[model samples]
Target: MNTSLKALAVFIALAGSAWAEDLQDLPDDTLLGEVVTATENGEEERLLDLMREVQARGLLMFPKPQTCTFSYPDTEFFGNEIFRGAVRWGFGTDLRELAMSQGFCGCIYDLGSLDAFTQERIGKPAQDATTSDFSVFRKYRRSDWSDVNERYQNFQLERCGS
Candidate 1:
């Protein structure tokens, strides 16, 4: 099989597993509907509190940016780190939105995008950190960042049904 076919196989396997897993512990559709109703009813505080509560409960998670190490000596830089970008999202881009805009219906929400949306709804900017001085996930290693990001995506699925 070609590389694209191999990737498709992996995607199928992951999707199948995600579907096969018993998510009985997660909120049902009715609960998710209530949350959506809160969004429409302007219960910002309740929504925010719910978001935080779920995160605290391990049902929601945060996604830190991944980075790679770089080495340079001529410029007096040694083993500095740089962001490597998420699986499909760029530093500030919304991967799920991009995919949906391209007409994909089965894609789940990207945690970065979901977090940014929630923050923006609460009148704060997205994590929006940059390397101009320091990064928000400055203390996080690449592996940790990726793990949290994947969990965050799962949280979106669990809480928001995306």
Candidate 2:
């Protein structure tokens, strides 16, 4: 890794509880976190370990984690930024209340592993993405990924009752 990337990882790892609220739009299998960092974006097991380190420190989560991968060039609305990539992002709803009653309707965070095909799209999105563009998955939280996604799903289920 480059020095800048390494420094970024260190900075993220040592970040404060404020990270508990920082949000980013990542593709499926991307773990939901702020301070959590990984050396291998393509290694699922390694990514999970990184996420667990964050959870172990009580960072963030998405209970009942689900995922979707956009393999072709596609765009999705993630908060404000429009990301274009062969994306893999964690999926969930607003079940943060279950994790802790002390959160705001503030930030939605992202975390997880991804293959090299996924790239972060920059600039204005050509168009909004539809369901057809993504391959979705629903699974359990055995690791940081599973636990985070499970929380996300549970949050949505609990809040929306769907």
Candidate 3:
């Protein structure tokens, strides 16, 4: 009986060590973070971390303005320069709300920033606020307003209970 108990204990110890070794060999993604510490350039790491969090939370997106002068270049509806600036500098959430409420265009602000620039721009978890899922609304638009509007409208309808 004593010899058998010793053998059992030895087997348990070996199994435990093997399990620990397997855990150590697991990938970084299996952990909570990317673990880019070895290449830690502070600025780059900070930016990458923010980007990772944004992607992880799925908030790195935004829609386009519905009534963009870009589509009707000849028509100056809201003072071409003013309209452009408004799109550039205006709060993304406000723009999204305006599009859904008034225009054909739809907007979604997905950029993750904890600092509140405007009431609408308070970036938080998507589960916290439905609108925080920018990817659900529109992708990061560079130019095509029409595509952005279409995507946003679909997203709003799907996610925001439109």
Report the number of the highest-lDDT candidate. 1
Model 1, range 1-162, lDDT digits (tens) per residue? Answer: 699997986676456435534333445443344345446657686556545434433332333443322222222111233432321233323443343333222324432343454244333333333333233233324345555457556655654455
The models' CA-based lDDT, in order, is 0.41, 0.36, 0.39
The sequence of per-residue lDDT tens digits that candidate 2 reaches over residues 64-97 is: 4434332333334322232222222322222232
Models 1 onward score TM values of 0.24, 0.20, 0.21
Question: Candidate 2: which stretches are off by over 4 Å?
Answer: 1-71, 74-86, 90-143
Leading candidate by TM-score? 1
Clashing pairs in 1: none
Tens-place lDDT digits, model 3, residues 1-162? 999997986676455435534332323343223233212334364445544543433332452334332221233422345443433333454445444544221223333222232224325422232323333234323345555557566755543434
Model 2: which ten-residue window has the lowest total lDDT?
Answer: 112-121
Better of 2 and 3 by lDDT: 3
